[model samples]
Target: MLKRTISMTAAGAALVVAAVAGCGSNVQPIQVKLAAAEVLTQAARKTAQVTSYTVDAVVNVKHPQQGGGKMQGRMVYQSQPQLAADLTLDTVDMAGRSLPGGARAVLQGDTLYVKVSALQDLLGSSKPWIKVPLTEQGGSTEVRQLLDQIQRFDLGNMTQLVTASQDVKAVGTESVNGEDATHYSGTFPVDVAVQQLPADRQEQARKGLAEMEDVAFDIWVAADGLPRKLAMNGSKQGATLDATLLFKDFNKAVSIEAPPADQVGELPQSAPTN
Candidate 1:
C-alpha cells in the first residue's frame, strides 16, 4: 500500500512545489528579498556540482473528503544526471491513521519502480499509480527541475512568480542558523504565474495555474555563492504549504547509473494504449 501511495504521490507530487509558500504583507521589504534571491542564484551557479542531496521531507496528505495525514522520512539521493540515481529512503517512517507504513521507490531514468505489500495494494487499487512514459512525462523531477528553476533568480525570472513588478528592497543583514544572512521583502505583482504543469504541458494552460501568489522566499546564500537555506510559504484554495530547505555537506560527486539487472523488475518499456 505504501508503494502505491508513493506512485500516486508521484503524480500529485509533480505539482507539490507549486502548492507551497505565500507572500506575507510588508514582511521584510522588496530589495532585501530580491538581493537574497540574487545571492542564492549566484551561490547555485558557483557550486561546482551537486551530485547528491539528503532530504528530510515531511509530507502531509490531505483530501477534501478525507481528513489528512503526515509522514516524514529521510532520503539520500545520488544522481549522475541523464543516468540514474541510487535513492535510498532511510529512517522511513510515517504516522496518520489512514496512511500506510513506510514507503520506498527506485526511480531510474524515467521508470519509477515501486514496491507495495498486498494489504497496501488494496488501498490504491482503484487509483492510477504509474504515469505516462518518461518521454511523455517531460522534464520534471526533484533534482532535474532545480537546474532550470534556479536560473529564475536573475530577478527577471524571480519576478514572474513573486513580487516582481514591485521594487525589491533589502533589509539589514542578520545571522541565520549561525551564518551571516541578508533579508528582503516586497509586494507581489498583481499578476504572476507559477508553473504547475509538467514542462511539456505548461504551455497549454489557462486558469488554476498553481497557488504561487503572494509568496516570498527567505533565501540564505553562503558568501561563497552556495545556498545554505531557504524558507517559502504561500496560500491557495484556503490551504497553505510552507517549506524550508537547508543545504549543507554539499561535497559529493554527482553520479547516476542504470539500475542493476537484479533491481530492474519486469516493466514494459512502453505504456499501454486503449
Candidate 2:
C-alpha cells in the first residue's frame, strides 16, 4: 500500500512540473510592428504639435576602402524645422586620409554656414565661415545635397521610417539614456516603404530608395511612446552604411539663429574670367 502511495505522489509531482514547463513555453512577447507602429504614429503626431526640441546625434560613415569617419553633433529644431542642422564634425577621414581640424556647419533657412580648417587656404577671406545660399541657379550642388541629407535627421522622418517598415517586432527591453525602453527590430523594403507615404512624397521617397537594396532598423521606444534610440544599416553600390541616432529632451526649449552678418561671408564667385 505504501509503495502505491509513493508512486501516486511521484506521478502528481511529475504532472505539476510538466504544467509549469508548459506555461513557461507559452509566454509570448508583445507584437510590435503593427501595435508599435500605431503607438509611434500617435507619438509622431504629438511630436509635430510641439514647438521646439533639441537633437543629439552621433554619425559614423564607413567606406569600403578604409575605416570611414565619425561626426557628433546637436541641433535645435523649431516648428517643422525645414531641413536644417547645426553640428560639428569631431573627426573625419576619407580613404585613410585624416582631415585637419574638425569642421562646423550651421544650416538655417536657406543658408548654410560651413567652416573647415582644411579648406582655409583655398577660402582666402572666408577663413572663418563660408555662407552659401542654396540656389539652383549657381550654388554648390554638393553642399546643397549634403545639407539635404543632414536635414533628414528629424523625428518626423524617423517616425515615418518606422511606420513604413515591413517588419517591426519587439525583440526585448533595454535602458536607453537611463530610461527603460522597448527594443524593436525591423526591415524596410524600398518599394513597400514608398507605398506608405503620401502621394506627394511617394515619388521622391521612391527615387531616394531606388539605390539601396533594403534597410534594417532597430528602434528603442520609451514608455512615452517616443523613440529613444535608432540604428539603421543599409548597403548601396558595394558599400555599407551604419547610422545611429539618439533622441531625448523632447519638447525642450531650444533656440536656433543664423550667425551674425558681419561674421558670415558669401561664397566666392567663380573666377571673373573663366
Candidate 3:
C-alpha cells in the first residue's frame, strides 16, 4: 500500500508540473519581454542543438494540508533520434517514512517501467521490475488514467517556457551544483506558455492548470549557455507546489533499454498499468 501511494504521488507531481506550464486563473498573462527574453531565446536554441543530457535533481513538494515529500534523483534524457529517459531516484520521503530502496522509472515513448527493489519475489518472481505499458497493450482503465496525466512531463517544456517568457533577466552569478551559473528570475506567463502547446494539447493543458495562480519560475544557465537548473513555484487558494530540475553532462552518451525480459513483470491490474 505504501509503495502504491508513493508511486501515485510521483505520477501526480508530473501532472502538476504540466499544469504549471500554463492554464490560468487570477493569473495574469506573460508577454515574453524583450531584454530577458533574448537570454532565454539564446539558451533555448543552444539546448535544441544538443543530443542527450543528464540531470541531477532535487525536488520538494507541498500540498495544502497533507504535508509533502523530498526526492533526490538523476535522469538521463535523450532527444536526438528519439525520446527516452532513464531515472534513478536515490531518496524519496513522501510525508511518511522514507522509501527503503528508492525507485527507478524509465520512460520510452509511451511505455513506463518502474522498479522498486532488486528482487520482485513479492510477485512470485525474482524479476525486480514492474512494467507499465501505457499503450493499449495491457493495463486497467484506472491505471492508464493516472499514468496518462504524467505524459506531458517530457522536460521539453523548458523550451516552451523560454520561448514564451517575457522578463527573466540576470539576477547574479551563483554556483549551481558545482559550476558557476547566471541566475535569472521572472514570473512565467501561464497563459502564454500554454498557448505554445500543440493545438490538440492546449485544452487539456489549460484544464490541468486551471486552478493555479501566482506563478513564479527561475533558471540558471552556465557560461556555455546550457541551463543548469530550473525551478518553478505555483499556488492557488489552498495548495502550493514547488518543483526544480537540474541539468548537467550535456550531449551525454546514454542508451535506454527496458529491463531484461526475464527480470520484468507486468504491473498488476490492481496498481496502475502494464
Q: Which one is best on lDDT? A: 3
List TM-score per model, in order.
Answer: 0.54, 0.72, 0.74
Candidate number with the higher TM-score (1 or 3): 3
Candidate 2 per-residue lDDT, tens place, 59-103, comes to 445556655645454544554445444555555444455446656
Q: What's the best-to-worst order under lDDT?
A: 3, 2, 1
lDDT of 1 by residue, 1-274 (tens): 3333343333222222222211111112123334554644444334324444444434343334434434344433444443332323222322233234434444455555443332234433332222213444442243233222221112222323433324445566667558776654544422433352235433321111234346545555545444445555555555444545444444355454443555334423332212
By descending TM-score, how would the candidates be arranged? 3, 2, 1
Residue lDDT tens for model 3, 1-274: 5345434435443433342211101212222343557667666656656666676666666666667767677767676456566767787776564657777777777777767652253455466777777776655443354345444533444555556666667788899989987788887666778777677665655444434554588888777766778887777666665767767767757798988888778766554222
Best by TM-score: 3
Off by over 4 Å in 2: 1-34, 62-69, 80-84, 150-153, 198-210, 271-274
Provide the clashing-pair count of each candidate structure.
27, 0, 3
Q: Which 10-residue span in candidate 1 carries the lowest summed lDDT?
A: 20-29
Error of 2 at 50 (Å): 4.4
Give candidate 2's whole-model lDDT.
0.54
